[model samples]
Target: MPLLPTPSYTTSLLLSNGHVQTLYPPLFRKVAILDAERVRIATHDDDFLDLDFLPATAEAACPNADGVRARPLVIISHGLEGHSRRKYVRGMAACMNAAGWDVCAWNFRGCSGETNRALRMYHSGVTDDLHTVISYCAERGYARIALAGFSMGGNQILKYLGEHPAAVHPAIVAAATFSVPCDLVGAAKVLDRPSNSIYMRYFMRSLKEKMRKKKELHPELNIEGLDDMKTFAEFDNQFTAPIHGFRDAMDYWQRCGCGQFLSALRVPALLVNAKNDPFLSPTCYPVYTARASEFLHLEMPVTGGHVGFIRNHEDGCYWSDLRAVEFLRQHL
Candidate 1:
């Protein structure tokens, strides 16, 4: 299998560094207002995933009056601790909807504005929930389906595509992922850096809060040292690993990292990783593997940080969102 040419991605000169590019958009950019229709889908294990559907504009709607014109559908999976309503998620949904594609932005368990019934929370590698979401779309008779994921969600989608190469749904034509940390262990180490302490603090606050609530609901579950934990690695070791059945954080990262699965992807997929992204390690680039695989397209820009790919101050459109829609449209 021959490699696909590396795609080009231009970043804003003003948002020069990784942190500025990454933090600026979510904090300062104007959010797209969406009238989302929320739907709760029950999982096989009795837990539920909350999904928000945004239909295309009237001009972009299906040609058929019955709404069956082989309309393309895009399923977006948010990053860790991120819900469907996040500004980036809404921005992407709005762009796709305006381009004649129906968007389904689904939230991971315990992230849909409510605590999940089960003791387990979503992890970087968990793909069963994603499978369930895709299955739901498949059963609905969608003619073309594409996937777009951010950060941890990107890892899950890539892992799902690689793990189930032979079982991929016929309707799922392509995928696009942004700021993915393909190497889980490396990502944890990067996040533990002293300079990244602010990010770690922000994330831990949400994570610990969720755990505090989880402990309250499931008293029978053994989760000690929740208060003393400081780093992400520590929290994963204490809770994310054992509660989800891994021996420890290292074990979970080794077994679940998506880098090990990229070579097996059978569907066309675009992976965009900014070289300056604060959350990624060198291994996350996967340049060699992408060059050898027929289906994978790797795009590494010099500046876009984390999930931030803001093009410029004047035009608020994110480079990732536009590129994702463009790539998916090519396959459609």
Candidate 2:
């Protein structure tokens, strides 16, 4: 029953090609999100996370005015190199806010346009920062919480929920995710292909810049051959693995990939990974895992590409936005 129907998702006009669907939203989609009230919270690791709150405009939805409003809140986590205000994050925030749900879009370490104090940047499996955001919202008094994430953020949410299902927060009722790379090793192989070089270069450019900043801040850290490195494999092997305590890139992927953890999930989680997503490999679909689990629902649409569920709706809501709100409403 958890494996969902994919026909529910229809691509926007002329966005049938996988790459076209993947590239269209970031290049052309501009959504006007609700006004955000920003807040910064501390992490247990001596760093911080910036949270952008878009409160529901109900009669009494303010955070901790008298008490946290009894509204259900959707906490959104963004993708790799993504922050709270990215078009995709804000677009979903706008859609959810219109449906009367409070929104908290949290930024990963160093992603809020500020250099983080920690030497290590965010990774696919870093759930502690997410836990900090979730704990903040839960303690603030919101009665219900639903989680939504894209790409890396989605992987983090899945890993967090499945890592200790019996210990998950009570208020976190459901999760909805899109364009998730549940299998990092396989996904990386696909990403390394020449056909996906454009996306790879985009990622590498930002990553290299961040490493340069790290080098400037922590001269003791070694980054001697950083420039020559071009692929995620080379970069993650040298930096992402050792700094984050993984033995190697393969070790990082095996430990962090959410596919292995789905069976332990206790809450309802709908992972919508587009069949045409240029970022994923065949192992990412996780059809067998979802079929074996009661809580994990995997939906693979034939057309929508990486985070691209573009639907030219009169309301400006894409298929993903509509589907997320619908699924969350059913469970919340």
Candidate 3:
């Protein structure tokens, strides 16, 4: 199938209240974006803190007119092996901040190259940490909260909303997830395809290195048989599943998969995905499940290349970040 055509972005959106409103300019696309500066908020010693919170500082170029405290909080979640410093994350943060929202990008456990100290590593369905982050925001009196996640982070956000619909605090008004892996097992198969093996190798190398680092801290971590494991399934079965307390990769996929969670999501959500994403096959697309949810708005763009939606042409303008901002503006 040909890739989904890229959509044009406009500033105006029609809201449910029968009013058309203009969103802030997409300053994030213009700015060079910022490098991540880390801040350590809490230690794992506290009951709520399992890993140190390394919140990335915003570029400050897109300050909200409503003042920092009054704006809605936009929480960004990065994909596997990615940190808050990624250019896309920074771009998204800048867009949200420009749109009168305070933005914070979260670094998953051990993702910022810091050892988590805990035996368990972060997984796609790990929503407790996200909940804690939301609580931190709520306590600071940010009455409105929204989320945007890339890839694995996307999977986590959808799962989080579904798993804790009733328990989610009132502050979280809506969310947007991009390039999500709706079916992990099916996605694993896609990654194993000849066309996508390069991506598979890249991800597995990072994952294996993390495991190797973990093995260094604890000699008896039992990673002896994983040297030849090339597939995502093999890696997850050996490391991700066992360490995270799941029975196996299939069990993890079955429980953590986000496709089944669409029906339960009450908040307005924009799920943007790429049909050509290397991590997922055609079967991995959750079109049917997404269509079932009145609250879910799905956008499957043709390109993007597994969150690599730089959207720049041979010369001049690009539109991925702008489109993302526009989608959020329309929904939230």
Candidate 4:
């Protein structure tokens, strides 16, 4: 892909206390490093379902006891069938918290074992809930906000950042994503592989259980037809697309995919994935771009499995935690 052009000096905003700069050295200059002292904080459940939001203390050095000023906030979003407590999310949250940042691991609509009340479901590229959370922070006067997501959540973050661009809340300084499925169709095809059956089955079980509960709550909606359907495609077609207003599964994936939207991104965003991530097929990796855009960068590593950047596999000192916080520190 063509290298993105560097951003020119633009209007700058300076906050009091010599903190907060609108521009920074290029993202490439920030080396991925690791940190410790990540602390686990409080967790809360969203209003709808057992969906829990784990808001951890990313940087205890800065406190929010007064609800006024604190360290910048980094919202963590998990991948499909994952939760805020996942090792990756927790690790990253703690790492950033140790570095003086507040962190919250957002549980997607119904991923935390609780069913959302609304008929509309969560999907790649849906930004309503994310926008809601960011606006909540902005309204509270948080000067800086950052986002980090993995796998499917990565896709959602990328789409939101790219689509909103100039419209995004000014507090959002930077965003980073890992194992993002830029092309949903490509990912779906890859997940259909025989080796991926285990992963697919696990997601399918969680999804069907949620649907069964929804059916129980609203007995009028006949969902018995879903009993025979197996694949993620069929499940999405029967439930996700129709409820979310998509014409079909293919349409949903196309509209929700992040690949076509990167050129519009305005925030400093980092996209990272390993060549071995199980979710991506060879065709899904971004192609060389002819136009250099300053808004986005792609960091493709040779290892890092699907959302599994197991830090220092040998010494047990993985680098994900540090990479996450450093990315935030660079832009926020």
Candidate 5:
């Protein structure tokens, strides 16, 4: 398929800048999560992933005139330090439900408002957790499935598809992602900048707090010197790599970066990474991979910061959510 044309998302004059665009939604956007029935599924390793499901309304669940199946599922993955209830995830779930699809917004381990039981937690790569989610959905008899993810979760979707093109469930037909940090090595560099210190501190604070709680359960966990760590390099090297079975931060970034896996996606996938995303590196935009691949449709908009694609809509859906629903509906 041809690459997507440049999409338009106009922020207010006050929010035109990347940082403002990124910060406005979380600081101000409010999208109520209605009728989200939380389901907990146990992992093989005894860890758990929490999924918030919004089933398609009965009016929207009927088969199409063409007799296409009803109840197609869209599984959405959240960003780093994010959960199923984040505005981005909740908004997309609502949009999908409105468009006649069931939505499953999954929380990465330890991100579901409770620290995960296992000693280890989720990371940038970790497609195995996604596999467990997909497989669980498949077993539940959903005949059609699509995927949507943001940032770290987006990287996981691409890596999951690329790592196992032939191994993907037949039910999964399409995918859409926004603001992905696909190139982890470059993303680390981008996050280390002085301009991004706000984001760095916010994330480090959240991660460190989780570690403090996790330490209570797994006392062997080292929570020392977390106060000194400021960047992903410092924290990932000290904690994430050792706990998640990587040699170090560099090895984790190298092995887990989704840039190396884009060309291998079998399902029709839309990756819309904004050019002005403050949280991403230029390497995160895989122009070559998208050009070479038949399935991965990479759309680089001029402005969408991280997961923020604010749209002035009555339904409270953002531009990113609407765009994903637009792309995914074509396949469903």
Candidate 6:
């Protein structure tokens, strides 16, 4: 459980601090154009998950004498209010595809550019949907499957692995996560700060919009004053917690935070967090837990704000994307 050396992640001197390191790339990085086969997988509760499959590039694809495609698969779960089409998701998918791997970037409910049928939306701790996605991949006979998630998605992946360590599919060899908010209660406090208000505003706008749409679709559900809720904690207290069966925002965070469950994970997992990330609290570092667990590896870079891990101005590629692929390849 000893802490591994900080992975080789160098933040651009030009992009100083956590916010710049986190926001610059998403705002200016060249868009990654991908040709993906979109598949809608049905869930047990009759809802659905939208999955975008990017097959390995021809140069990277491995085929047998019978022309059967054989490549490792990487399942990517995006952050809050993010979908498979987001720039970072596509960028990482493209990287994995170029490295001789099939990439499936699956969207959480209500995130895939379509309204989800269920009244309940996805939360940081939700794992049943992840289980469904993994089952789909397992049934397809993938020889090696790795999982990667960003921010809130990272929290879900860790929670899933920890909560159901014994239930992981045999093909799921490893997992990687970036900029995870391991401590949800602490993260809420961070997001509530004035310095991080930009992010809070953006997220609240999206959440309110989604709630408005949900109210329209299900008029019977009471979502009154959703528009007035200004902060993440308030929004979650009014909607997310009750809809998902938690008592309130704090209760939801307490029950769902990944920090409490990391010790139970059995998979070879790599978790990367930045000391300067605006979204995390000190408790999110998980230093002691990582040092005590044989299966978990923690990488704490000095600066990589949120999900941003840009190395330099010369190369637009993300450090987290490359490192995630490398970590998963080790187990593959």
- Candidate number of the best lDDT: 2
C-alpha lDDT values of all predictions:
0.86, 0.89, 0.67, 0.67, 0.88, 0.86
lDDT (10s digit) by residue, model 3, range 88-200: 67767766655666676878878876767667878888888788778776665667778888889989888888876898777887787777888877877776888666567
| Winning candidate number (TM-score) | 2
Flag the better candidate by TM-score, 4 or 5. 5
Please estimate how well model 3 matches the true structure, expressed as its whole-model Cα lDDT: 0.67
Tell me how far the alpha carbon of residue 313 in candidate 1 is from the true structure, in angstroms, after superposition: 6.6
The deviation in Å at residue 208 for candidate 2 is: 0.8
In model 5, which regions exceed 4 Å deviation?
A: 58-69
For 1-332, candidate 6 gives per-residue lDDT tens digits of 74778766775577858999878877887865888889999999889899988888764344466544478889999999999998889888877876778988999999998999999899999999998998897666566789999998999999999987888777788899999999999999988899988998999999888988998888987777776888988888888898999999999999999999899989988999988999999999999998899988999988888888875534445788788888888887
Clashes of each: 0, 0, 2, 13, 0, 1
Of 1 and 5, the candidate ahead on TM-score is 5
Which residue segments of model 4 deviate by more than 4 Å? 1-67, 289-291, 313-317
- Model 5, residue 209: what's the lDDT? 92
TM-score of each: 0.94, 0.97, 0.81, 0.79, 0.95, 0.95
Kindly list the per-residue Cα lDDT of model 5 for residues 1-332, writing each as its tens digit. 54777876677777777898899899899888577778999999988889887887855434466655468899999999999988888888988888878888899999999888999899999998998998887766677899999999999998999987998878899999989998899999998899999999999999889888999999888778988888888889988999989999999999998889888888899999888899888899988788888999989888878888877778898999889989998898
Candidates in order: C-alpha RMSD to true structure: 2.1, 1.5, 8.3, 10.8, 2.7, 2.1
**Candidate 1 regions off by >4 Å?**
1-8, 58-69, 313-315
Tell me how many residue pairs clash in candidate 1: 0
C-alpha lDDT (0 to 100) for residue 3 of candidate 3: 22
* lDDT of prediction 1: 0.86
